[model samples]
Target chain A: MNWDAIFTSLRLASLTSLILLVLSLPLAAWLAFSRWRWRFLIESVVALPLVLPPTVLGFYILTAMGSRSPLGRWYADLIGSPLPFTFEGLVFASVIYSLPFAVQPMASSFAAVDRNLVEVSWTLGISRLATFFRLILPSAKNGVVTALVLTFAHTIGEFGVVLMVGGNIEGVTRTVSIDIYDQVQDLNYAAASRTSLVLLLFSFIVLAVVYSLNRNSPLWPTLRKR
Target chain B: MADAEKTMTNGARPLQVSIKRNFAGRFLLDVSFNVGAGPGTVLVIFGPSGSGKTTVLRCLAGLESVDEGTIRFDGEAWSDTAGKVFVIPQKRNIGYVPQDYALFPHLSVRGNVEYGIPRARREAEGPWIDRLLLILGLTDLQQALPGSISGGQRQRVALARALARRPRLLLLDEPLSALDAPTRSVLRFELRRQLKQLDVPAVLVTHDWEDALGLGDQMIVLSGGRLLQSGSPLDILTKPENLAVASVVGVETVVPGRRVRRERGIAQVQVAGLNLWAADIDQPGDEVYVCIRAENVTLEIGSATKSSARNHLPGVLLGVVAAGPLMRVKVDVGFHVDALVTRQAVEDLDLKVGSPVGISIKATAIHLIPR
Candidate 1:
């Protein structure tokens, strides 16, 4: 059943989601609260992944991470390896591919926080940065969870970016989606269906968890009585 | 600029503000005033909606910037557009309570109160936090989240949160506007008492006249984003400087009149073909507006009783409306005049629409502003 590919996919999705979460926190905060005149330009760029085809994004990312580029050369010098075709390259591509999934929910929720709460915090002698941590982050708990879940699931289901950036290496870069394609190409219908069923079930459960967290009522009705 | 520096040296008042800011869509805010020098002083900015009262308070708190002028608090310039100095709100050391109270829904009452204290000093500030909760009568509900508390309780939590910082100044924007009517009245006196006990200099913005009169030691009337008048609360209520100030301060009856004659510090003015006597002013103009507050008017049935009031006009009752504890009785005696009488008085006098009524207004009760 290609358990090696399954484990690799799990590792890549976990690392990619974690990296996206850390990078998206400050980026989403700036997008939500900044009054800069050119802020819409940044917002448009962040939202580009939502509309752009994965192959188009992967093409740019692959070109940028090639050994000839400055970023590629610097990373190769530091890590003694070129970026493309490695598991690290796959993680980087997934982060950019799923950027909107992590950022949109968080930015919208942060923007929805009562403006008065933030101003009151400032008036109470809390700095803006402190207020972001103390007040805003806690208020946006549901959105943060949604962002993590969506990013993790999106990274798992990704195909085009992963294949373009990280070539099909059985244990290193062949994720569940890539493994499914490899199985079908080899006319191994039984293996492909098993993997497809797992992906479908996983996606469904992730969505159910997100919707339940965001519902107005508590997920367990009995707990609300107290 | 020279004059601003001169006032800075005096330092008699604790807060001084003179700012001009232009907003989009033709709204221009230009105001200048100084609050009292003493602690426990409360200066209220009173106006109707869209009058820039909240904007003025926001400017004072450093939440909103001004296009011109300076804001001086306790001899330090908080905002000076000319000098290019603008202190952020965190460094301003000010407590601010917004209209809605804005309690953190996720935090308990105690958590909200303790939010302003630095984490390093939170342990040292524990006793103070307890005292604040006790003083505000929130000790019993210290662990209750804001969403579970009543409106009045939420307000106290917001106050506690702001006060925990031990700020030099307090800014409240329509502090009581969010509560229901009954809760608002009960909290009004309680808020006044708390402010006095705390002895903090505060600036409050409110559209409600009752809030201004009940809480302020000094009042500034604002309308159309301009400072119309500044004086004691009673003075601004009884004697507004112009028609705009008169309307903003809720003077119920204002009619244009011409001064016919002056005698013994009393001027006889003809308003709506009715001769009215008002306290005389030597403004050298005949045209004036006769402004009379509804509360200052007394309504009588049948023959007028003997009183010091100089103007008594026989009229027909036009309408009766309930206004809190009072009944607002409108009468027409050549011109419409409003009088606020107790509900019991309404029943005793059997006042009803289309009934004969008499309105007696004192000479001093009538204010005259040159048209």
Candidate 2:
């Protein structure tokens, strides 16, 4: 309810979404266009975090960086400490936790762009890089927007990953989800209700805007007709 | 290497699509022929379905990759498998119009026409597009989308788009077969005039002889992926190299026969079913195939009495095949021989399948060659 908490949640959600877009881009593009026979393996891995319980993912991240594995030990030496109980670790865990919500819509949307349009653009002497930026990404705008809003909202409402990794460290790692949990644990029901309402309202507003814009889109129906 | 060298020697000038493609398990298309386009030169690639006419165009346009060949347009090697050189389609400076009229559906008539020019030249596309629109009678439809226009309009739009490219060569794949009769005729005339006025070479593909006769200055007939004959329309039509081309060039019937005797210019050949006389038989050869149109074999309904035509054979009316206004009457005189007769003749004779009739062939009507 306070201005600082609201700002913190907004910043955290924005940072989480930015990280998600960067991490999911190649995976999304690959899923959209790759013809390799073993593509299902990459697809299943991207999709695994979605169906797997958020607690399960958080628990794995906790163990993976708990000085047990060689990667964790090496990372610990580089940072002079282990990854668990850090804000960066929470962001890293949340990116995987929110990947399906970010990338599935993008891949499907990119897949729906007309191959003829792409081929013609290429044959028209347009460079491949221009074709990707001007044609592919713009044409797949709906997917990008869907990815952005879903990742942002999903990250804002995160509880399990942050809890398992950040261990409720205040200010640095206590996001809106952890804040609400702390409020409820202290019997501060009013503060918890306010945070929950804001998150619910934020998600509803983002989803409503995305859905409304999609209704007026010409590219989406053309894809459906095809 | 030998094929490429021979083709270069044959087509050393401008017609340089010297290629042979083997689409494994599908079919083989090895066509090596050359005829350039200028004010009075338009090459017609006439063939049956799946004869690789369109593939030839694509190879030249640098669209379909060839297994072995050199596609040189204006001395630039677009593709040379032996030389391992290739130029992409955009840089080739060719205007390709596909069979389906592959115009950008999203663009307006003017937009489609103005597609080929560089962005810097776009501002000056006005006069060009205007001239093309005026030529195609599409001045008013410039703002209209392709879907909202007629088939003839779409054809003109696609043609204008190709023409606006100002390429060295033009490629059209059955541009008129999709239109109605009247529109086809109108577009045919307009397209021929435009091609001539442009003074650039063209390769037009079609399965229809009418297109060849109406538009082509250099007509090439093809069948089953081989060049049957190539020459001017009249030259190819009247003197096809073999039976395969004679049939394609409107010679309706091909009868396998042997030359028997000759007197002056006229020669007699004993065929399996009938005797035929042909003029100008320089070398009718040991065995020959006489090609004749049914209309050339004139039909006369008689009382078994008066007729001066020596080639008359008694036969029963087989059936009637009427396409549009023209009628083709098939007659079976013991052997199956078609007699293309006028509708008026059918009426006058009261001709039907069981109707008894007679067929006559003038000596000049028979175009004969080796089988």
Candidate 3:
């Protein structure tokens, strides 16, 4: 069992979780409280990655970020680079793949906020945007935390999306989950065992934060802790 | 009633809610009323459930949008459908206290009160907030969360929070409904005093007759999504517009019949269950409603020992129902009438079902409504 791989996966998961947390808050607020009737449509679109296969996202995103596709060409032509095969590309894919774990919690939490409070805030002459930032977000602290931890851990466990798009670029796209798989494919039992241990431990801690905070997290703790 | 006074005031920013909502199939709510807010004034909307009292406040607060109506505050239009003017609640600067108080469980008592206050107003809000808490007797519980607090304390917190906004108008939707009797009494008195201090226009919605009489300076009786009557509480209770309004004002009897003739102040009406005379009348009709207060009727053993009361009828006691400290004796002569009697009087008479008794109602006590 390699402590180093476990630590690396833990760090990657934490970072991914942080990134997902920042993105889901506003999007969830819009979906939850918007007067717009068409929010359901936007909600369904965001939830697409939850139901669709990871490979589908990998296929679409990979094409869009590749040199041949128009967006890919423009990205490549403008910046002399593409997102595919890069660590940043993996982060983006992880965000897309684990979006439901982050956004849904936010949407439901925001919905549960006491609408009277919102109304009171408005009657106090506070703007809608201000109400969201101060009232809606503060009340939804628990939901935001859950989304963060789940997205982070979910991204850490990714295999299909990374494999399709992020070709094992060491120190870049070679996330700990992929490294463990590579070890297994080679039938190097010692290396595979080490990588597997690291992945397990990394997942354990991210999930630990999630459980300790809110037991209603997507994943539950199998073993009880005092 | 009185407890809600300090808790909710409608001052210069009176909640002048006017709404006209039309749904596709059957649901249609058209109601309009003004709630006076200022010290020593309470506007109580009395009605049964589903009478649109709650809807009135919701429309005013911008919680429920009206298809056609106007909600104005202090002569400035809060919402006027005809003028295409509507103001969002968050932008309206009014305090709305709902039935359940709806305090955030995660927030402390102080936190709950400080919720709608902006960053700039926060510092300035402390003294006033503390005063409200002290007035509500929730000073010690400031740091406690709503979940850990008692129902009465939670109510006080809601009141404090609403007051902390220093709102121009206060709208309370049955604030004390969930509270027990004892707590309600104490809070009611405390609220009355505070309402006087706020000097803001306030409206309190309740179905309880005692609540309306005790708390309201002006009472608005609503029924079937319509405003039946709105005026001084005494006027509303003393002179209701119709049977529905009479019921809201706690008038015990609504004799749905007609006036046959009128001579001087005594008007004869052939009520469905009995023959009674109203001392006041404008027109004689084939169909009219007669309202009688339960306490206005007096009962005696025989028809001889007459007093200042003008109308007397011989009846048999049908049943007696205990209402608070008094027992309401249901008597049937030709017409069944309810006479509220003291418990001690009930024991003296040994009041039981089928006991023969003479029921006498004063001439002035009989109020007639032309149908």
Candidate 4:
């Protein structure tokens, strides 16, 4: 019952999460430590997806990446194909939709770190990069793990943006959520129920893992003891 | 000025710092001082919070960039704002111990100490860390995380971690301020011993007068982000330049007056409706403040006697307040005078709120500050 669709969704989610993590790490670090006055403007812009309607975001991305637009024409000329209605387009859309998920936790964790620790490390002759790896990352490991999980799960459950940008191409753009929608519309009740159950189990398992990890994180010492 | 010349002649490689910074058009810090960073020399910066004592220390360590002026350590320029010669904190070869004792929470005591050991020198100098831990009594606690240990132990670990670097200069910012009173006194003794043994030029900033007097080889007093005076602790306590410096160095009373006459070496001064004679009057008829320390004023039950003390005044006891080991006796002759007496002395004299007593203070004990 649409096993290829499920696998495609998993692949998309994994790739999007990996790319988002890479892109967001330095951005989050800068947001945490920079003294720039316009930092809040950038932060607000990054957080826009958290409250923006997914359809509106998808419509904008579609318009910006369509074959008629300048970016879409340039992409078509360079990549030999238009960006919209493709697997690549789906990945890009998911990354944008799940950006706040990846960034907020990381940025907050980075900001929450004691500045004295960083200064102490620097005075000890530890470079900024070394300090980030040896001290900052270990201290903020919990938030990072949460960000990765949220981004992956959010991408897996994406429907509105993926539908608008990817256009339901079989074995390529049609992920599990899109397959389930198609099944319900076609009155394939048994198939839709099976797919829905899989998603429900996946969501519960992801949340369970996150909660257990959070309990063990040293940031919540009381909860860890409990 | 004589001390500066003597320090220069001793080949002790002094750190010369003169900086002026104007911050936000509200605060200005103008300070200039030189300290001979000879072996076993401890320079203490004493001031209240927000007085820029820590700022001066940070500037010397290259932690704070100066707006104007230069900082030179052993003839090497650490910062010269006009010349655009500024060294980063890491390259300054200094061990800085902050007030919070910022130990890496993830690392054990041993790991923290070894953090600053250069990779090339780690093999040859690695044993120094163990030696430092042993000296600081942290050998058994080497495996413990900073949070797992007690506050006093964490302080030792911070000291050990800084010393492990074998730094050319050491800067400590109120290292013992976080401990309990008992622990603080205990650690202070230990820290003084360690600083002596390090044989490195060290600057410590503390608001506690006890630390300044007990640990400092030279003391620089600061107030309101400005240098009030710089001298030996004894000199600073006995010859403070102004009323502000006098109060900071534990002088309890500052009576403003003018010297009316100088007969021989003694100067008769009119102070608060009483005529008191102070010795060593270099400037006659000068407006001055007579600073008196509570400990210097002895309480006598009878009238003025022919004792060694040159000045005596009869006064009625205003109050007896218990202050730790000593009793603070407030007396009013015509003006209030405080005498710090022991509990045994209070009980022996049967002194109460209204008992009349005589306060005998020597002419030498009175410090003068030009008003």
Highest DockQ among the candidates is held by which one? Answer: 1
- The CA-based lDDT of model 3 is what? 0.76
What is the Å distance of residue B102 in model 2 from its true position?
Answer: 2.4
Q: Can you write out model 2's per-residue Cα lDDT over B282-301, one digit (the tens) per residue?
A: 76365887777666777777
- Model 1 Cα displacement at A84 (Å)? 2.3
Q: What share of the true interface contacts does each candidate keep?
A: 0.93, 0.12, 0.67, 0.60
Which TM-score value belongs to model 1? Answer: 0.92
Query: Which residue segments of model 3 deviate by more than 4 Å?
Result: A1-8, A215-226, B1-18, B33-39, B256-277, B284-287, B299-306, B320-328, B341-348
User: How well docked is model 2, in DockQ terms?
Assistant: 0.24
Query: Please, what are the lDDT tens digits per residue for candidate 1 over residues B140-257?
Result: 9999999898889888998888899888888888889889898999999999999888877788999888999999877889899988888788888888888889888889999999
iRMS values for every prediction: 0.7, 3.2, 2.2, 1.1
Task: Find the number of clashing residue pairs for candidate 4.
Answer: 0
Question: What's the lDDT for candidate 4?
Answer: 0.85
Classified by CAPRI criteria, candidate 3 counts as: medium
Better of 2 and 3 by DockQ: 3
Q: What ranking emerges by DockQ with the best candidate at the front?
A: 1, 4, 3, 2
Poorest 10 consecutive residues by lDDT, candidate 3 chain A: A217-226
User: Model 4 residue B369 lDDT?
Assistant: 78
* Model 1 misplaced regions, further than 4 Å: A209-226, B1-13, B260-265, B343-352
